[model samples]
Target chain A: MTPYDIILTVLTTLLALYLISFALYIVRVLKGPTIPDRVLALDSLGYDLAAFMLILSIYLNSPMMAVCALSLALWIYALDIYVAKYLEAKEVGG
Target chain B: MSEMLPVIMAFVAALISIVATWLAVQERDMLIATLFSALQSTCYALIYYLLMAPDIVLVYLPVSVGILPLITIILIKKTERYEE
Candidate 1:
């Protein structure tokens, strides 16, 4: 097979790997005893998903789709910050 | 294999979303349920990317993952943590 096919295979494998982590994150979100644990799991899952989107953009040959990934990462980080502060009682409705 | 990559990703995203939606509904804690809803939205964004809908992804991520959860959490803090 060509290098392109090989790259596709690699990307597909990476997608599967990220999805596995996604599944584990779901489980953690379900079984987590504390509020923070669930939030942390959601944090990692969002970041992993952004990485997956980046890889997918490359595989699909759409450089514009990476814009979605970038925005997702940024917004999720903002959510994390808001949640963290909310947890700390620093902000009430952030 | 290359041609089928998008199709495969779409299928997987669908499956994950189904499970995520169910998990969100079943969760007892409002926080965990909100997190699962975020996960469900993330899966939908991936589906949009797979389906070549960049505009939707741009809007969906910030609205669902960012704003929605923050609003929900604030509501939760004012109310109760555990669902009853």
Candidate 2:
């Protein structure tokens, strides 16, 4: 097989790995005893998903999808900040 | 076999999204439910990406994951944390 096929195989394997971890993250989100725990799990989940998307874009030969991955990472970080503010001050500033 | 990888990945993402939606709907804590909903949206975005719809993914990502959760969280803060 060519290098392209090898890269495709690796990317596919990584996608599966990410999905399995996503299942674990969802479990943590659903079953965690405290709100912070769920938020942390969600944060990691989003970050890892962004990485997965980047790899997917490379595999698919679509550079535009990389932009989505960047936006996803930023939005997930914003989510963390929002949760932290709400948890600390009991308010999310308008 | 390799050509169908995207289809398989999309199916798995869709299944995960279903689980997330159910969890979000049934959870007692509004905040946790919102997080689950965000997870659901993330999965949907992945599904769109796998299906080669970059435009839909772009619009869906901001609206569902960012704005919708922010709105729901604000409502949760205004009203209550627990469902009851």
Candidate 3:
């Protein structure tokens, strides 16, 4: 096999493992007992997904996927901040 | 083969972050989980750089590494719900 093929194989294997972890994170998000727990899982999922997209770009030799990563990063930050603020308000109201 | 090492490193780092994320989920304390989340973000930033997206790395590193954790920590402190 060519060196590129070997590299691609290894990278794909790692990506598969990441996808499994991503699925596990989804389970945690669903089963989380608290809002923060769900948010945390969601945050991790976003980051992992961004990484996945970036890796896929490398594998596909496309630069456009990096923009997807950038967007994910921006959206996740906003979502996490909003969730934290909402949780704070809930706690204060109690 | 040598030229592809950076990609390999990036993949391994992503793997590490995934394992860390798994551990974070298993943690019973929210604060610790949040810390892991931050670490996961840092790893992702490295992966972004490795993928030749320095622009994305620059934009996200600060937001994920700086802002998100600060907000989460503040919320945790305010609510006093560090433990699950």
Candidate with maximal DockQ: 1
DockQ of each two-chain model: 0.68, 0.67, 0.05
Model 2 chain A: worst 10 consecutive residues (lDDT sum): A85-94
* Per-residue lDDT value at B64 in model 1: 92
lDDT of 3 at B19: 79
**Candidate 3 lDDT over residue span B1-84, tens digit each:** 535656776887688789768977887777667756765776787687667776877687778766887787677767775563
Candidate 3 segments exceeding 4 Å error: B1-84
lDDT of 3 by residue, A51-91 (tens): 87788778767775567577667767766776566567668
Measured with C-alpha atoms, the lDDT of residue A93 in candidate 2 is 50
Q: Considering DockQ, which of the candidate structures 1 and 2 is the better prediction for this target?
A: 1
lDDT of 2 by residue, A1-94 (tens): 9998888888778777877888898789778888899889989988988898898888788887788888888888878887887887655453
What are the candidates' interface root-mean-square deviations?
1.6, 1.2, 10.0
lDDT of each: 0.81, 0.84, 0.72
TM-score of each: 0.84, 0.89, 0.52
Alpha-carbon RMSD to native, per candidate: 2.8, 2.4, 10.9
For candidate 2, give the lDDT of residue A50.
89
Q: Output DockQ, candidate 2.
A: 0.67
- lDDT score, candidate 3: 0.72
